[model samples]
Target: MRPTDIETLVQVGRPTIAPDGAFAIFATSRPSIEANRSLSRLWRVDLPAGSPRPLTRGSGDRAPQLSPSGDVVGFLRPDTDGRTQLFVVEASGGEPVQVTDRALGVMSFAWAPDGGSLVFVSPVGERGRYGDVDGLGPDAESPRRITGIRWHANGAGYIVDRPTHLFVVDTPDLDAEPLVSPAPAVRPEGAPAPTARVVPNEARALTSGELSYGSPVFAADGHGLFALVSEIERDRADLRSRVVEVSLDAAGASERVVVDRDANLTVDDLIVTPAGDLALLASSVGDSGTDFVAACIGLHVRRDGAWIPLTDPETIDLGDPGSHVTALADGSFLAQSRTRGRVQLIRVTADGAIEVLRDDVEVTGHAATRDGATIVAAVADVTSFGELELVRFSGEGVGRRITALGRTPIAAIPSEREVAGRDGYPVHGWVAVPEGEGPFPVILQIHGGPYAHYGVHLFDETQVLVAAGYAVVYANPRGSAGYGRAHGRSIRHRMGTVDFADVIDFLDAAIEADSRLDGSRVGVMGGSYGGYLTAWTIAHDHRFAAAIVERGFLDPVSFAGTSDIGSFFGDEYVGVDPVEIEAQSPMAAVSLVRTPTLVVHSELDFRCPLEQATRYYTALKRQGVDAEMLVFPGENHELTRAGSPRHRVERFEAVL
Candidate 1:
């Protein structure tokens, strides 16, 4: 499973249920390692038959959405300039018809309730940031600045012009119409006022300004649109987001919040049940690591003007646990939980009684059919390819395989382990061992969110390292999520101290427990916070033979100024001002580094920013420490997982 072998593992994403519940539409990537391109295709699975058929051919097909009538499927295809446009095809299978002309990139799209039209969001060219001219007037067009499309390198890339407003198009005639328009603010008589043409028949902005609304879902009755609104602010990773109900009739109408933002909870995947209740996936990080346990799947019933949690929090760990809940027509919910490297699909009754539906297969993505007789889920094993599986469950709780919708190999094997860290605390970790053994080199992998966990699930990079003859160990130190709020918050003001001690302790314990690990030639790698730790470890301890710091924090003070979330980190995680920044910075301590280090980052990564790496690389070179810097063009902090295929491959090769 080395980076080179990533081609064999098809990456699946954007799973959508078809109208009749007989099948599901999903997008998967076919990585051509030889050509250095990962081609994505659209696929559909028949639920009762458990068979899948390819809907699109060639490269760059993704974001497939099934029409409400199940008669057609819409998706995005790459154009000549690498921009993507909307296309549609018959659900039964046929040639795809390009619906939108290739111009600007299509960021996201949603089908109209009647299946006769669709609404999509894209950037307007030249009028604003990224050339997005969607809702701007003639006067505002020249300035080329849109409300949401501010370009500050890190923060700028995330901002889109005009806040990703919604636009609708009639499918039959391909006549584009504005559903929501940008709000115009009244200025003083002497002050300058922006002017933009109001396109009466074109798409209009539903909401305006700094806040963004997306993941739109039409209510079962088609009376309103349910979308997640992300309210952006200056200094916080915890942006205020909630489910908002917007009226489809009036473009400028105010939206009502269906779910309130709690300090611990973040909402995702909003859906309205057939019974007229709204359900959303809620994720929460508690006060400490122990309190940080998540409810993998929850059913929120809109009762008495508020959404009530139907699922008990104690029964599931939802934070990165990969639990999915699909609503059934019978009023029950299909809840799938991946526990300790195993996946189980359970049927949760409205009253909370849980019944096992199909416990034999590892269900990743699942959807309940309209008839409620069969459940379509994506299943796969470590060696088996990924495929859409249809399982018919009887009233007696028995399940029978209906069909093998699509076949895809399991990209990797996920396993869990517990090791003792410093102070005798239990630290959890995931280990992916290579096929062969002989004291193979080991990699001490650390997660980015010193607050995030190394869960029991499949990971592309872990498999890649394992396949490269490296035993990979990713641990949840004192500050990883899923343990509880206390555990997660414990790393605050103690970065590079307790967490680093935990890493050392875990490595010592792991090497002592396993003979396959060659501790003497170990490599350490991490990004963001993990990157900060990598640099700190090599400087403070000489145990690691080599290190790769990807978009990592080197100087805390500089990071606080440049990082997109820097203000949040300074106020929350480190709590260090300009005076103490250098004291806690790895670059300030770079003189002690002895291990050979590889500094890899993306030029566009405003999160860590290449400057952090440049500062360290220069210091290390000045101190005569062995180090090199590798920068990927036009990539951000997420380059390791989402960068160009060729660059991503090169990164892994350099690190391994």
Candidate 2:
């Protein structure tokens, strides 16, 4: 084993198991040196034997899902025009067939109930072309006319021209190939090489109009199609979504089913159980003077056309609100939840009993077997990346590891520790120390999402820092997820102050415990909320020797005006008053900072916007502080993680 370098770390996407649980398929991505980008390919692994092989050798294939019949696997890949389209190949190796050829390309898809067709979502312009360069064909270089508040997204640039809609494409049944072969492609030589039928996979628009529809789920009976539809609102920030049902063959007629008692709630996920019950996760929007917080995930079940609460109203939030639930037979569901700074598999029984199925490792992706007795999950820990594994419900949740996949980046496991905080709250964290080192420079890494946490999972940046002979330390502050709602929302009005103290306390405690850590040579770095705190730390305390702030906010008032989520973020995260926001801003105290800082920003980042970096850099220069700015072109806020491979390597190099 070798130390995991920054560039070679492979990324894993969704992993779906076959219906019979005989095999599983997943997407693997690696940075391409020639293209200066990332390329993904689909791979398959036989169960029990765990013999893994490449299923599709394409430039970028992702989102692998096995059909109900388990004969074919469907994935998304780009066409010649750079549009991502749906592709299907035999579960047994063969040439993949392009299933959909829409103009804009498919975003995501689900296998139809009969497995003869696929329901997919594609972004289309108002005039019905699939994002065809403002309906002027694929090669048109036209001016982007922005019309609304939510016109552009961070990573996905301009989105107002084309709102994503639902469409269904018919697929041809594949012939079964012999599963056992001597090699990857062992077809009989000169035996009439099999050719894919050139079928017309013209997609039909299932739903139409200006509003967007997503998370399309088919009824168990295959008659009704349910999805979350967002209606056009005067207030662009108000994403008041509801569960709507439409006939699978219908084209625009949809009936809303109130999943939330209050229509002001945002319906994130929708799933149709085997029993025809509509299970959805809804989050309430605070309207009164109370500080808006992430309330308990409201699990609703629609019975007899009326939605009713299935889980207790006060049910503990399964931690990660963005994680979807996989419904099992008899109405029970499995969800990936965060607890105590680690990812766990949580099972919500039909009667609403939440049980921790797997508590030791990070279960990133999972799929249920046809019998619903077993789950094939992609599990990873701090020292390793994702690998396919089988987890039986009858066991103690410590499933059997199946495929080793690729080499793990971490040569050694990170050590876990806890620091006592206010009111007996324990701040949990992990530290990865480099080998052959004494009093190493410490890189205090912070995670984003203020609501998202860093735990016992494989983080590439942390490994990269450790591999570079730096001691990496990260902890879950007061505002991170995995803890209950109170802890997650504790930094709502006090984002920089409370969370800053928690991190400082944890860092000091860690330094006190380890004699080989050079606390005086400490550098702080973070993205998004972590970036916000990084700037906050340099402003308040001058202990940090260097700082790297990636896509972070410096002025709350300017951020509230420029960010896509600016409309509601101030009301939700920070205090609404202008005076308080200015006081909390890092820009307000630039004269007090005396540390070398690196400001990284993306050109297309609409979340925090490029102004954040520019303003912060301007202040650093005006104050005559040591500062350098790196502006990534053709990238967004997710530049560090999902940007081009060459860029990711350069980012680490710059930070080092």
Candidate 3:
């Protein structure tokens, strides 16, 4: 049930299906304990006879894209200074040709249908203006300056703004040009809609106003484009987003909404079905859990004025709900379902009946070819290392499996147990004991988002802590996501009340049950809301010997004014108004802290800024509670996943 010892889990990303459906390309990183450090390589899988083969051997290759014609593969690679640039290689696997040599970072790119061109988005300068919200003064000349009215005022505190629109590249020669030019003028309040105009090399404007749009997909007929438009309304509980279709032939365009609602829903993946309908994968915050639910993933036909859903939501979640559906050229579709925490590939008839095609392998990421017969899936299990598998299916049944890429084993099975929470509710958690047989120091690790769940995904940080000779205990308390709506919403207006007690109760039970856990040598660590919980626990109880709070909010009132999702957090998580904020904020209760703690924050993180960490650090120091602060430069809320490789390693080392 458990690995011999804990090791770092390799990070995998950007899995894309090949045109012929015979294979997939993806990026994988080696495990490292250092902060802000990463080394990734590109790999390809062949569906029938062979395992996946490495296409690029060195570090910094990522965001793999298989060309439309399946003749070439493109990805981003690090240059001399470590900034990423685009590179392309032959489908047969050979030397890669560098495409872009820009000083700014190139994070993403897509191949054009004709295979002679591509489109990409990257930072414009060495110090990009993308995420800068303060606006450049006279001396600031960087193109990465953050714009867009709503983002400017909300100040999500990101180091870089979203890239400046889309850009197109002519292949072979590889020259790039912005797709939308002249940047639409900022319209005044209540102003009449301006006359639509098209700029050369730029796509027609689909939506107006200062809000931003991205994730563009060309229709099957290539006559229209589907893009996601975000509108940030002042004082709104959540950011408003809608999918709009725009005409490609006309200079002026009209848009029709594909998905629109009051809740926060962001499109994650989209593809045109072989039947000429749109299939999409979206993430939304619903009443149940965080609603990471997969939508139709089949087909949505346009009818009357709106697009109608072809696949039923009930059916999508029935056999396998969270799995994505991919359309095949022959009109049949591939549906992936999660059965008992493992993913299975199922072939669905046009009428909606499904037959399990592949069930033995554990599938994570999936991509289908133009024909449904072949599938590229990422497969891994408790003992198996991460790898991309090329799976072929035919009239007979599931076809042969070919390895596409291999990853080092990075996860360990911590002992699983069910403990009683403060309210006597059964809480499930994992306790990863260090290598030594005798009692080891314990670290109470908490997950962030408050509404998110820590599921069966191969997590690296947990293994890292275990390797550091610390017994790590991570639990799903009442408010954690994935359980159901009632459980997740339990801590809404009672942040420090029940949830806090749940952690204490769980730890008490765990220490009593496990002799390998040293109760007196315990420490606590968490990020974002988890950080808030860590701060709150140390202030209210003296059970912990040391604590680390990463980018956590200390004052609900100040957080409401500064955090990007302030309105939503204030209205739902904590009760509205300054009174409730004061009652729930850990900073407001700083006078009670008596435990040693470490405060960590990123300078550019808008979610929970450095000020929040500083406030807690200052309070603990002044109150004679030992404390220290660590700040990461040019990092955002995603410091753990996307920050500079070196800094990420440092942060882990400091806390450990």
Best by TM-score: 2
TM-score for predicted model 2 compared with the true structure: 0.90
Ten-residue stretch with the least lDDT total in model 3: 196-205
- How would you encode candidate 1's per-residue C-alpha lDDT over 15-104 as one tens digit per residue? 667655657788777567676777788876665445556777848888777787878888888766677777777777776665655245
Which scores greater on lDDT, model 2 or model 3? 2
Please rank every candidate by lDDT, starting with the best: 2, 1, 3
Query: Candidate 2: where is the Cα deviation over 4 Å?
Result: 1-4, 126-147, 173-199, 250-261, 287-292, 295-298, 303-322, 393-398, 422-424
**TM-score for candidate 3, residues paired by index:** 0.76
Model 1 regions lying over 4 Å from their true place: 1-3, 18-21, 101-103, 124-162, 173-211, 234-238, 250-265, 283-325, 334-364, 379-381, 391-415, 432-437, 455-460, 576-585
- Write the residue-wise lDDT of candidate 2 on 1-656 in tens digits: 22215445566666887777677888878767578777889888887566779998897999988888888888999988888988889898798877777777788888877898888998886553345345567455556665555666676766766778988878755553422323345678776655443344567788877778888888888766788776434444665566677676454445656453245556668877777767777655555422336554556665666555565543355436336678877678887766776667777887778877677777777777645676777777765666666777433344777766556566447899998966566888888888875688998888898778787767787877777788888999988877777887888877787788888888888888998889989999999988888999998888888999889977788887788777777667778877777767787777788989999988889999999899889989998999999998888888877787677777777887
RMSD of each: 7.7, 6.1, 8.8
lDDT: which candidate is best?
2
- What number of clashing residue pairs does each candidate have, in the order they appear? 51, 0, 28
Identify the superior model by TM-score, candidate 1 or candidate 3: 1
